[model samples]
Every structure is written in structure tokens, then in C-alpha cells.
Target: MSDADAPLSATPRTRLRRMSQKGRGDRGALFEVLRAGLVCHLGALVDGCPMVVPTVYGFDTTHLFLHGSVASRSLTTDAEVCVTVTVVDGLVLARSVFEHGVNYRSAMVYGTPRRVVDAEEKLYGLRLLTEHVAPGQWDYTRAPNGRELAATALLALPLAEASVKTRSGPPDDGVGPDAALGLWAGELPLVATWQQPLTDPALPATVAVPAHVAARAGTRADRS
Candidate 1:
């Protein structure tokens, strides 16, 4: 079976304990949430204290890749960690403040990340990471050389143990007593768009913006 066709199982650490109705079991859902997001919060224990770092990430069918400086303490630790990605679609305005919620898709993965050392795999993983943030960028930019690669660190975390949850649509207080108060209850959608690219002041005026970069103007930033 193909990696795309394989199913994702919720391990003990990933199983949803609250708001279970929003939990999604399909592997595709997890992939969609991850693909729609560019930033993720990595939670780990450093020196016996909880720490969460916001970082960029990339993922394939089976693994998620994270990169940082070689001296990063969080990436060097071998302990189990959690990575979470959330994309907020909108705000759910309800009649009652207590009933308000946000329209969002979120996913959490738990595991110990394995440090990547192979030169070929490291380059491949770095390419995936670069393309994930800016599509078509890998072809337009120069690749990293040996000295730069040696100073970088990469980690691979499996997607086998993960869970996804999503919430959308209008507010849920329509049938409650709060509805009689005549307050507006609906969704205020959030949309993210890319603005025009700005050229560096030091660059020569003859230098033109690349097609891949210019084409993204006014396009949705969150869509894969």
C-alpha cells in the first residue's frame, strides 16, 4: 500500500480527551491541516522546564522535518516532544460570550525526533522545508554548500502518532435562551493574502522580481 493510502492511528498520547466530536481519524485530515499551516509550535522539556518554540516545518507522507542551528538545545534533546499546528479560519460570534469559539483546524503529533545525519537525506529534507514555506523557491535560489550544511541541524519526526481536530460553520447558540436576546450570531471569516513583493533597496534597479515570487501577489497565503 502507498503511504497516501495508509491510515493514521491515534496513540495513547494523541487520543482526544475533550471535544471529542471535533476529532478526525482520517490521515488525510492531518495532512490537510499541516499543509495549510506554515508555522508550528514545538513543545519540549529543556533542563526540566517546559518550553515551546514557534518554528517553520515541512512534512511528507510519513515524516515531518524540522531544521535549526546545530547548537539548538531543543533539537538536540532525545526526549519525547509534541508539535502542534493550528490554522484559525475565523471567529465564531455567538449570543453569549461563553458560547463563542473559533473556526480552526489543528493537529498534534507526539514522538521523539531522530537527528538526520546523512548528507543526501539532509539536502532532500532541506529542499522540502524550503518549498513548504515558498513554493517554487528551491529552483530559483542557490542550494546550500558544505560549510553551511555542516552548521545546520535537521530532525525527522514520524507522523504515525498524531491527531487532528477541526471546527467550522456558524455559532452554536441559536437554539439556546441567548438567541432571544437578538444578538448577531455568525461567522466572521478570516482570509490571508500575499501583498506585492518589495525589492531590496541595495539591489540594482535592473534586477527584476522572479516570476515565482511575483505570481503569488494577492493569492491566498494559507492554501497549499
Candidate 2:
């Protein structure tokens, strides 16, 4: 994708195009790819130097919201941000080592991100952030105190400039003459699943695993 701040096509022209198979154009495709991921690579510039960092993000239908410690440089500045999220589901095992590949879903967004500053909106943004991780956990846990609230920064990136790339199924060369070589040639799928939760040693058994946490097993975000 071009580094220009404008939205790329639904499937941007990139080195990975061969694996990008989404049929829809624009927003539909981008949203689908984004929804399939839990973490995103957020890119921005600080003092003319390019910086790309991994971060957790949440989204409403029209925008993506990112939050971090108030001390985080990425959220503090009014930089034009580019966020990309990718989720890999399998390793393509081919007879030839040169043809190895991974099946994945990805989305990239470009824009001048706006930081959310209002207290009410920030609280709502926090809910979007937390609930996006575990649908019902926001209300069950302790709400942020004054100190915690003052230490968090949130930025919401619009869906205006975004695109998606996705890949599925088996390797293209899996059925070539290499197939007769007797070498294994198929997809080795990777899946993410939640394990049991660990509770704080000081907490009593009366503080049960909230339904939100209990329901998270097998969730896509639980990807290992």
C-alpha cells in the first residue's frame, strides 16, 4: 500500500497480493479482516523517524480506538497513524521448502488520528477497548480510579482510509510434480484457544470467574 494517507483499494497492491483473496471492495472487506484480529501493528512518525509498534485496539463500525499508558509517545502526539492487524491461521507445508507460506487475514488503515480527551467520551472509549477484548468484562471489574484515568490515552482512527488482505485454503504448488515426491504437502493449521484463568493469590474464592472471562475460551482473541 502507498504510504500516502489516502485509503488504498479494497485489496491494496502490495507484495502479498497473491494471497489477498477478498472479493468485496472497500469497507466491507477491511472490516472483516480487522474483526478477525486481536492485536494490530500501529505505525507513526516521531521527529521524522518512522516507528511501528504493536498495540491492542478496539473498533466501532466507523473507527478504531487505541489506548495506552498516558506516557506512551505513540498516543500523546498528533501524528498521522497507520495501523495494521494480521491474524495467521496456518502454515502452508509444501514439498519444496522454498514454497512455504502462511494463511492470514490483514487490514491496514491510514489517517491523522484524533485523541479522545473528554471524560465521558474517554470512559466510553475505555469500555469499547475493554469490552472489545472480552465482551462483558467492563462492568464486572473495578472501574478506573482517578489516577488510572489520568494515566490513560486513547486515539480513534477513522475507517476512511483502510483495506484488507486475506488468504485461505491450501498451497498452490501442493499438487504439482512435487506431490509425487512422497513428501508431506498440506496445511498445518494453527489455532488459538483460551486456557484456565489465574486468579490473584490474595483474592478469595468468593470472587468467582466472571461470566465474561468464563465465556472467552475458544474466542478468536484467545489465539495462542
Candidate 3:
């Protein structure tokens, strides 16, 4: 990968003691981890106090974007922010209660976000955010009008200071005294799938589910 697209030199959750090996140092893996997730928690120090807020995030290969109101006390500032994304793949069922864990992927992105002011990039970023969630809705929906654009706030946080950590399969301690417990030990895999898209209540009676729209609901790891 090119340098800009490379993973962070450090793992994001170095301070979190559990599942440290899941913290990958490569940038590309982290991006893939983030892409697999829809929601993210944004952590930042507002006036030297820590704050954590959950929000929707969209990311391209190079940059991660978040949107909110311009009057947002936390997002509008020039201060640095920490963004984290997670995907729960499955539940690790261990033979013993103490050995249970989750099979998931998570990443934390750190950077001082650049407030997006360029009108073209703002619209483009919005499109990216739209497609990230509802892939085909951008072309079908009307473009943002002036008043709508005026009321929105967007921030671009560089996809840096990130890392990926994943856990899967069975408990790491399946071959000890726990193994003699006679309990069924294995992974209870959790699969995520997008259900069929629900039609808009305001949709015109003549409107039918387009192939582009219908395909989204059945989407899962099969597409990934």
C-alpha cells in the first residue's frame, strides 16, 4: 500500500489490556475493519475533559468523515478527535465462564479533523456517506438544496492513528481443565445481514423496488 494508505505505526487501543493482539499495526487492515462497520464512537477531549459519543461514520480508503450540526459544541472545534469502529462477528463460547469472549473487529482512528468548507467536497462527502449505508440511494434522491446544505455540518478526519483487532474461533483455553468440563465448547457465530429494504412510506404507488435497491437487503459477508 502507498504510505498515506498505510496503517498506523501504533495500535489504537494500546491502553486497553485485553485482546491486544487483535490490535493490528497495518493501516490497510484497519480501513477494512472500519469499512465493515456502520456506526462509530467518537472520543475527544473537550476542554481537557474526555467525551465519548456514538455517531454514524463513513470512510473512503483515505479519509474518515463524520457529520453533525455546526452548532455542535464538540465537533466544531479545531481540537483533535478519536474515532472508533467495531464489528461483532460472533460470540466465543468457552468451556468455562471465565474464558468466554467475543469474536469481533475494532479500530480507533485518531486525528485533528479538518472542517470541510469547500462546497464541492462537502457534497461529495455526503454522497460517500450515503452510499456507504444505502449504496444506490444517492442517484435516486434529489441533490441537497441550498437551505439543506446551509444547515448541515461536516468534518473530515484523516484515517490515521488506527489499528485493527479481531478475535474468532473458540476460546483460547479449550485444551485444559476446562476441556474436561464436558461442556460443548465452540463459537456461536453471529452473522449480520441487511434485510430487504423497506419502501418509503411516501413512495409513490407507481414506484417499484428497483433491482439496485432490492439487492441491498440480501447483502452480507457474501458481498464483502
Query: Candidate 1 on 81-190: residue-level lDDT in tens?
Result: 99999999999999988999999999999889999999999998999999998999999989999999999999999898998999999998898888899888899999
Best by TM-score: 1
TM-score of candidate 3 relative to the true fold: 0.88
Tens digit of lDDT per residue, candidate 2, span 1-224? 43233344543433245534553345665666666677888888867888888987888767788989878877744667889888888999888988888987777788888888888988888898777667787888799987888898888888776666677778778668887888778899888877777888999989888777877766656333
Q: lDDT (CA) for every model shown?
A: 0.90, 0.75, 0.77
Worst 10 residues of 1 by lDDT: 1-10
Candidate 3, 167-195: lDDT as tens digits: 77778777787788788988888777878
Model 2 residue 129 CA deviation (Å) reads 0.8
Which pairs clash in model 1? Answer: none
Shift in Å, residue 138, candidate 2: 0.8
Better of 1 and 2 by TM-score: 1
Of models 2 and 3, which has the larger TM-score?
Answer: 3
Q: In model 3, how large is the Cα lDDT of residue 83?
A: 85
RMSD of each: 1.2, 4.8, 2.5
Assess candidate 2 and give its TM-score to the true structure: 0.84
